[model samples]
Target: MKKAILYLVDEAGVIQGVQLSAELWKKAEKVVLPLLEEPESQELQREGPLKDFQTLMEYWDFTYPYSPRVRCPHCGASCEDWRTDEKHTFILNTANLGGLLVFHCTRCGTTIRHKHFKDHMSIEHTIPAKYKKS
Candidate 1:
């Protein structure tokens, strides 16, 4: 089953606007009200997931040598190491000890998911509907 069909993400993420289902909205109103009261900057500036990224490196089990290059599949934007990009082209979305790191491309609305394995690292992406080309 899809996990998050309750809230709309676009119009955007983290989020420019939120469209919640009536049932869920009614229940969530209590929790969501306080969150809205002390509103903060929509864009949370993170220096990158330094500690978690380091932990993933330390436990590297991939066959190839460790490299930090991250490229957006939807757009041609590539970075040698996303964590150190001065332009901030990608934001770390998720990372875990399970060897999966998800990054959101700043140049395009595509999500880059890197799954590290013992033999190699598997990479994949999900582009937002608005950016889908014919």
Candidate 2:
């Protein structure tokens, strides 16, 4: 019989993860998924700035549709979709009704601003306080 599950190990032979066969995964799905999902009580609270970012999009009045992409000029770190990026590179710092959105870059302590205008968008970034020359 073939191995039902493959144990992915590190160089030191410590099991780092598991790769399951389709048949075996089907059997374990019922038991494993809940363990991975967020707890009920935890889910009740706010999920973070991501929700606020989405709320601001609903109020967007820009000429072009909203784009989820964000970039940090200070550190050259970027996220295609700030909402779903697993790395959490850029964090939503502020979202307001006046068509202004601010993000704080985790990789570099930079503040990025996306200012939406009627015909175009303006991008601005401020270097971290530590990097600011006196």
- Find the candidate with the highest lDDT and give its number: 2
Residues 84-130, candidate 2: write the lDDT tens digits. 88877777777776777888776666889999888888999998767
Q: What lDDT score belongs to each candidate, Candidate 1 first? A: 0.75, 0.77
Candidate 1 global TM-score:
0.61
What's each prediction's TM-score? 0.61, 0.60
Candidate 1, pairs of clashing residues: none
Tell me how many clashing residue pairs each candidate has: 0, 0
> Could you give me the TM-score of model 2 versus the true structure?
0.60
